[model samples]
Target: MTNMALSGHTFPSATLTCPNCQTTITYYDVSGSSYYGCPNCHAFFKYENEGPPEILTTFQPSTATPVLPIGSEGYLNGQFVRVVGLLHKKEAGSFYRWLEYMLLRQDGRYSQLAEYNGHWMVIEPTDHTYSHYHVGGKTYTINTDEGQYWLYNQYKPELLNAVGEFDWNCLEDEKLTISEYIRPPSMLISEQGATDSKWYKARYISRSELATAFGIAKDVLPAPSGVGAIEPADPDDRSGTLLAFTGMLLVAVFVLQVILSIVKPSTQLLKESYQTESDSSGTIKPIITSSFDVDGPTVLAFNLSASLDNQWIELPVTLINEQSGRVYEFSKTLEYYYGVEGGESWSEGSRDDDAVLSRIPSGRYHVNIYPARDLGKPVSFSIGITQNTMLGSNIALLLLLFSIYPISLFVNKQWHESQRWSNSDYSKVYTEEDKS
Candidate 1:
């Protein structure tokens, strides 16, 4: 009787007698497969020129089994591919290990499914040309005809074990160098051997996707660990959209400010200069301004300015309503200081300042100013009052509020990028120099 395994898709099989253990081996010589490691006897065989296969090597039988068994068929990438071979390899001088499944399509093209740390990737050969770039100081970039890529990893793989069939002799002890360059969710891999070089492109695949493709339970699959090398940091990043929104809001706020300024221009109510006066008994009398009428429901700006070399003046003032005898008391301080420090001009304190009283009702009012100076010298200052003034501070506050979210998004994006690159040798954050 012929032994066959079928799961929707089927493959033709042949039987070969293992010369070492004299046990019959069932192999799927699918798509020009020429090498096989006997499952029962653990002996490697190679077939050439339609002749009887010759034994290459033999090993103690292993108790381990592959996750995706040999001869299993899976629908992947819009095509049905058979898992014809499996190879277990580990990075030389490191504990990193991975499993590679050689997949054969009906048209005889080969692809690979690789798994590391529970992360999976579908790898396929590419024919496009590429250029290597190393701009020094931890910058390793690869420019392909397709796009740009950043160096992710470089390693040498030592084969640990193998089973099933392959296009080349899997038992050969050949040295190969592999390099991976990534562009997030996709990677470009270069394999260099003693004789030739080949390039392949690999895309990240999720465990759920693989389960659906192979008709397996997702819970039975390996759970993922840390972030994969080429996995997307933020698949739904919206930093650009947020920046555009912030820019639009800024323009809108500026236009609104201009419109408001033109509609209710500030009207100067009173402008006067005052000097402190003293009575015969040396009692200083407060200076008073002429009464002014204010329109209801508007902002009143009290502006004060003084000229001083390095002195300060304080004015305790009150807005008194002549009709109601009600007083609104406030105070202002003006200080100016400047000097040359270390051959550079430095200045602190302003010669001019203003305070605003908002929502003042319509009424006749007068200002009372009680002046005090740092020195006993007589202090002279100018005071101006304006109505319905539109403050630039309001617009500045709105701009800051609108910019906060976009700035936060930018910072978060940069942080995620740094985390993604943390595993790479060319990490922008923790570089090799930093590691050393």
Candidate 2:
């Protein structure tokens, strides 16, 4: 689309010549502002300024503090009223709040609604009793446009005589007319009683009332494919948000470094109590007289059924702390884990891999042995509790020396994942999403 101007397009307005009138009428950018026109034409009409019309009310507005009960008085809008909810933008682009209300009759049952981006509409009914109007005896026309989805109207809260922050306590008490929903703090009426222009204006109030709104729970069914949370219908605050994130990340980096620097207690300071053994009859027991200690690079739990004779099985060995006089019972056997080379199993090192949490407080706690698996079967495996394996004291000491590292790594990893999620689909996200 290209067209050359007929004049030296100067004067504030980028003027265009009207074809019908041939008069040089100043054109306006899509945004209505400055205009162009040959001021001499007797038919010197003004610019086609089609913007949000100024709202005017001449009725004496009301000011009822406590919101009128829905069943109290004027609540229904001729059976076709709309309940407008607000998400008043406290600050341009900060965060939005939610408002909800109930519409009677034609608007459906306790239908739920929300701020269609900070703006909503309410129908000013003509009668309070039979709040219904029909056209041609069959079709009905609604008096309010606030119930539908994706609609907005902006108005000056002051024009409606609202102070601080006000809400339309009741529909019967207020009647407002919004010409166009656009930029401008236009009229936000809080109609209490009879009203008119100049002499009266609508009042506003913030009532604490819950609308019997109905909505379904979020769907959690497995997705057929990648899906996303609908983008928030409103703007988001990224500046301050991003800064908070950056601060969290720096803290994490520092901590992760410290953790990697802490010296994990030498794997050399540990002793085992006993070893595990199984007979040819597939029976097992701890090979301990009372309690023994051995280096912990431990492994190998096996059983054979060959030269078997008399049948007898001892209950599995359970762990207990004689110091506290508490016998820590095990079901069959307790499993342990550690990061190891590919060939290395969960019990990786040769019975010496120990980093257990046994000591935390100032007490002489001892270890016991019992089965933690195969409920009825006798435990026939030699398990080792090195002097330092999972020592609570050692772990606490380790955590204190450098809580920043692993914690930072964990938190940073988590934060990034959250950011990724906020910007991505829930189903497709994972721990790696926050790698940045």
TM-score of each: 0.73, 0.25
**Candidate 1 lDDT trough over 10 residues, lowest sum:** 1-10
Error of 1 at 426 (Å): 4.5
Q: What does each candidate score in C-alpha RMSD?
A: 5.1, 22.3
Give the per-residue lDDT of model 1 (tens digit) for 1-436: 2254434454667666666776766666544767877777777877655677788887665534467887778898888888877887778898788889988765568889998878899999999646778755666778766677888788888776677778787644237788898887899998888887888999988888899888888987788787787766554556667777888888887787688678877799999998776779876778889999988668888989887668888888899889989888889888888999899998899888889887888899999998877756666789999998876677678878887877787677667677767776674322567535
Model 1: lDDT equals 0.78
Q: What lDDT tens digits, residue by residue, belong to model 2 across residues 1-436?
A: 1133432111122343432245443321223322222222212122234432221222223232212122111232233333221111121232322233333234332222222232332323322221123332222222333321111222222221211101223222224332121111111222233353211111111111112111112231111121111212212434345556656765775575466335332332223333345568755543333443322232112111111112222224343334555543332323333555688744321221222333233233344433223323332333333332333454456545554545555575456444434432122222343343
Error of 2 at 203 (Å): 31
Q: Candidate 1: lDDT of 314?
A: 83
Q: Report every candidate's CA lDDT.
A: 0.78, 0.29
